[model samples]
Target: MAKATTTIEKRVPTQAEQEAEALQEVMSAVAKNKDALLTFLDVLGELHESGALDMAHGALKSRHQIGVIGMNQLNKSGAQNMIKNGMNTMQFLAQLDPNKLQTMLGAVASGVDNAVQPDAERPQKKPGLFDLFKQMRDPQVTSSIGMMLNFLRGMGAAKGRE
Candidate 1:
């Protein structure tokens, strides 16, 4: 008789596991480059306020690089609590110089205003009554309207029966 073979299946990680892994990577990175990490955060804060970050979305998407670099540095420095202390330092800096935070806030507000404001040269479209009526003639829209009308008619008939 031939020996029966048994196969073992590996379980895939769930969403929570993946998220935890990502968080671990970020924490490890933050712990490694205490000084450089602080500088990078400062730059990020400035860029975020200036709206430059939006333009750099493609480049900034590589958070893994930042994390790995930070982790490698932290591993070298052997500072396990770098991330915790860094947070404290950031809070202290913000408190110590309120003017800096105010300036950053002002920049962020201006950036938001600039982004939301429409350009004068861009032509604005105003839909006419005919345009609205034309949409009602579309097959999908007509079908949807028909369904709604049927529902309303059913409701009215039900009320009349009562």
Candidate 2:
């Protein structure tokens, strides 16, 4: 009978073998994504040609200075007010009924398109006071006036609460 094998030995990979395996995996990935890699390279070349890469590098190098300048600007009252106003506007829009807002915006766009005068008809005469009063009596004009009055009433109520 042959001698009984009592132990099994495991062979560990060498550093060079490990590196070769990693390179093979990376090459396989590159092969699999050849089109994407080529597209990315084309974009990179365009960016380099446009000096965008250099600009990006320069910006990165000056990041700390940029941060300080940004901070300084943001600390100003005007910037603070802009941020506050933006938040208030967003809050106000969020509270509106979406369907009504969509309809209102569509109507506003239509109204603006209708109001635009052709360049050839520049300086068309304004409506006279009597004409304006007559327009106020029109159904569409009355409806718009009512909408504006409701908006003003809501604003007034908000201001009063503040």
Candidate 3:
């Protein structure tokens, strides 16, 4: 019978060898993304040439001053008022029916467009009070008046609550 032999191997890499392995991986990645790296470098070079990079560096250096200026501006009464108004407007808009608002905005936009672009087919004439009263007979006009009346009633109720 032939005798069988088993071989065992154990190897630990040195620090330099491990570093070299990391460098090899980095080199492989650089090679794979060579085109992208080159493009990025080209853009950076252009920015540097245009002095944008310098301006950016200067801005970064004066970040504290920029922040102070911004804070000072925001601290002004006008800025505070603008912010308050914007918040009020946002709150009001949030409470509104989006569908109705959208429809109203669409109608307003269409009306503006029609006003800007006059129709050649229709004879333009200033509507008289009698003509307006005659239009009140229209169902569309009646519905709009009804909506306005309800809106006025709501405003009255709100004023009462206030």
Cα lDDT of model 1 by residue, 47-131, tens digit: 9999888768855797788789878888875476877798899887866558866865776686577557745763445658997
Q: Rank the candidates by TM-score, best first.
A: 2, 3, 1
Model 3, residue pairs in steric clash? none
Tens-digit lDDT string for candidate 3 (23-67): 999999999999999999999999999999999999999999999
**Is 1 or 3 the stronger prediction by TM-score?**
3
Error of 2 at 90 (Å): 2.6
Candidate 1's C-alpha runs over 4 A off are 1-3, 44-162
Candidate 3's TM-score reads 0.56
**Residue pairs whose backbone atoms clash in candidate 2:** none
Question: What TM-score would every model get versus the actual structure?
Answer: 0.26, 0.60, 0.56
lDDT tens per residue, model 2, 1-162: 899999999999999999999999999999999999999999999999999999999999999999999999999879989999999999988999999999889878877876884346444577889978977877977988898899899899999999
Model 2 segments more than 4 A misplaced: 1-13, 96-141, 156-162
Q: Each candidate's root-mean-square deviation in Å?
A: 27.1, 5.4, 7.8
Candidate number that wins on lDDT, 1 or 2: 2
